[model samples]
Target chain A: MSRTIAVVAAGAMGAAVGARLAARGARVVTSLDGRSEASIVRARAAGMIGVGDAELAGAEIFLSIVPPDKAVGLATRMAAAIAAARTRPVYVDLNAVSPATAREVGAIVAAAGATFVDGGIFGAPPQREGKGPAFHLCGPVGDCAAILAGHGLDAKVLEGGVGAASALKMAYAGITKGLTALGAGMILAATRHGVGGALLDELGASQPELLARLAKGIPDMLPKAYRWVPEMREIAATIGEDRPESAVYTAMAEFYAAVAADHAGEERETALLMRFFAGRG
Target chain B: MSRTIAVVAAGAMGAAVGARLAARGARVVTSLDGRSEASIVRARAAGMIGVGDAELAGAEIFLSIVPPDKAVGLATRMAAAIAAARTRPVYVDLNAVSPATAREVGAIVAAAGATFVDGGIFGAPPQREGKGPAFHLCGPVGDCAAILAGHGLDAKVLEGGVGAASALKMAYAGITKGLTALGAGMILAATRHGVGGALLDELGASQPELLARLAKGIPDMLPKAYRWVPEMREIAATIGEDRPESAVYTAMAEFYAAVAADHAGEERETALLMRFFAGRG
Candidate 1:
């Protein structure tokens, strides 16, 4: 039996996820309300039917796949819409947020009589050749991964509830993206010291593997720096308040914010970093 | 002609450096005023002739190689002693300190009629391997690297004066030790989330190079974590005041402080991290 699924956003991952399910005979639905033209086009291309927030109650599963900052707010709004409904679909949040945020989302959706699944998506869209993109699932509502997996999307059920998948995500991203932030910070600091080029050369000569990672990571991260600021803060909070270790990610937040502004304005630092790495490449 | 030189503290690196000089026919002197029996033993083994603070003024060069906290104070005390001398030695500040502190030391020594050199040492003690441990030199008195190089030390003269070598050291150390701190912090953060074992596996599978680096770094760092706390703080100060990047090192300072204490107490995080990486290795 084909399941009727409602995907909240039709951005790259959301649309690709919908396309995967739609190909496998599932009826995919999305709300195009207040979305950009590109998003609408993507949703349509992914074979998603446009629906209203009020109509979201008709679906079997609701997957939230928006920016980190919008994760909670969207859940709140949807919970409100579903409050008067007799039947509520399971609401799954698959955003890059902290465990604390996931629990908050859990509380909201549960209050509305909708099951909440904490999810963390790790990997590219489902179009890749080998293996499905791992959509790590957790919480009381989490076995939803099994449903998505049955539909050809790679879904994984993590053992711990609510915060587990997100905790895994936060820790993983803290290393991957956090390394990028550290590399960029070092590059900027080295540049300030006038040994920027020499440092790169020296790193290549000795720490070849690290230099290679930086070379690949910097270009991949530049355009996405704006999106990463809040993600870093989420990572910081995930590290928790009791320990000062969280400040490393907090520092990363500022680093990304500065780079984001530079990338947006095409400033000198932006031009230099991109050109330096691209040239080296 | 063989030169008369004095090493301020006969600690590990200092004793080793003095031994290298003493082995090469330099008259190596040290002050054993308030050192431990172990330090006195090491100094004697290194062939360092014991001298008073008054006698230190008689040497051609006096190298300051204590901990960062003690770097400035040692310089001040030595400045007072050397001030009464007819011919004061070059009081080169060679501690792991910030450029600002290096500059402060420079002022102190210059007021005492002694030339000040800023130096940063890289690599293990001299008796180890093929290449000599590099002593990177800067500032007016920095040309003294030549004197050390003449006696088997690998001394390199950098272009910038005073703060340049220390700045280079800070930048270099921030990347090297800073990366170690970041790695340990992430490891600890991951452990808190209950996916610690999974993370190590995932990292080994995905980021093998980084995992390899961590495997090498953590064990090497665990025992030395206490010594590194102040170094992290110095690196933080070296990142300067305006930028928030310093906080990353500040966080590292705290992280290392915790790990150091854990190592001393043989606590769980310490045991787990050391065992995990050791088992992996």
Candidate 2:
């Protein structure tokens, strides 16, 4: 059966995912209002039909895909559209936000007579790398991943419902992206001491694996760090206020923000890290 | 002209450096006062002459090598000996203390009419590593590196005076050891999210070098972490407050303290990290 799906905001992951479903013969629709020309083009190219609120609520499912900061606002919009049209579509949130945010979004949609499924995308979109994205799903309808798998997504239903999928994503990103900050901090600190070469050499000799990871990861993080700040904040909020581990993620948020700061506020650590790589290259 | 040297508290680094000088025919005298039996054995094995206060003051050079916490106390003792005998020895403090602490020690020694040189040791004692103990020396008499270089030590004299040598050590250690704490924090956090193996796999795939570093460094840090606590404190003090970078070193100190704490405290982080390695092996 063809699934009427509304994929909101056709960004990198969203566009690719929308395309995957459209190609699988699902009736994929999207709202590109107030979107950039680039985003509109992406949505059109992905075969996602442009829609107003009335058309949006006609879909069997509404997938929320946006930045961490925008997740709540987008879910609220979907809830209103569903309420106005007197239709109850399953709304799945796939944003990189905290569990608390997910629960809040779940309530917003539920109050609007819409079914809510919590989702956390583990890998890249299916259209990217020509592979199935690992859609870790939780909540009552969390097995929505199974439905997603029909379009070739690698769906995994977590036994722990509701916040499970979001928790998984937050924790995973906290480690992967968090590591880049750690590597950068240490490398620049070593450079300050003039033992930059010595430390790198020792790591190369004794911790060769770590040396390789830093070489790749730190450089990769430089351009994308701006986008990671809010995600780190979400990770911090998800972990809550009490645990000491909360400090680690919160510190990462500050680290990324510093890296993204302007030239006058140019982070000493960031400058040194850039210099280290520039010298190496 | 052969120089007379007094090496106080012949521990790992002290005994090794003293032996290097003694083997080259320098008169290396030491005091085992209030030292452990192990330390006495190490001092004797290094062929150092046991000395009282009068003999200590007679030496042309006195090297104070101890833990970061003990650096100031040892310097105070050296100052007293110089004051009591009314004789001056060029006192070199080579502990892994903060620059501020080093300056305080330098002042204590210099007040008694003894010349003070600041020193930072980069590598382990030759007894452990067999070579390449880059003794970075600073201060007005920093050329004191020339004296130690004769005994086959790899000594480098920086252009900067006082504080510089200690600053180098603090900054260097802040990164090397700090990175270990960061890695452990992330790895254990990932474990809490039930994605420990997943993170390890992802790291192995994308950050092979980092994966390798975490494998070795985290495990190696276990027993020695208890010792690293004070060094982290010194690094934090050296970086001081009002800078974002200082937080990294401070967090590392807390991380080490948690690891050194007992099991009842349930250092979930420490256990996960240890388990990761134990399972790997």
Clashes of 1: 1
Name the best candidate (by DockQ).
1
lDDT (tens digit, per residue) of candidate 2 on B1-281: 67788988798788998888888878899998778998899989998888887789778888888878888887777677797765678888888888789899988988988889988887557763366577777787644678788766777776466777787777656656666776676566556655566556555654565567678878777766766778887886776565565665666676677776733366665667877766531
Candidate models: Cα lDDT each: 0.81, 0.74
Q: Interface RMSD (C-alpha) of each candidate?
A: 1.7, 3.8
Please give, as one word, the docking class of candidate 1.
acceptable
Model 2 residue A190 CA deviation in Å = 7.3
Q: Supply candidate 1's per-residue lDDT for A98.
A: 93
lDDT of 1 by residue, B254-273 (tens): 98898899889967787777
Q: For model 2, state the Cα shift of residue B130 in Å.
A: 5.1
Q: After superposition, how far is residue A216 of candidate 2 from its true place, in Å?
A: 4.9
lDDT of candidate 1 over A141-233, digit per residue (tens): 544777888788777777787788888888878878887777777677766766566567556655778778888888888888887899989
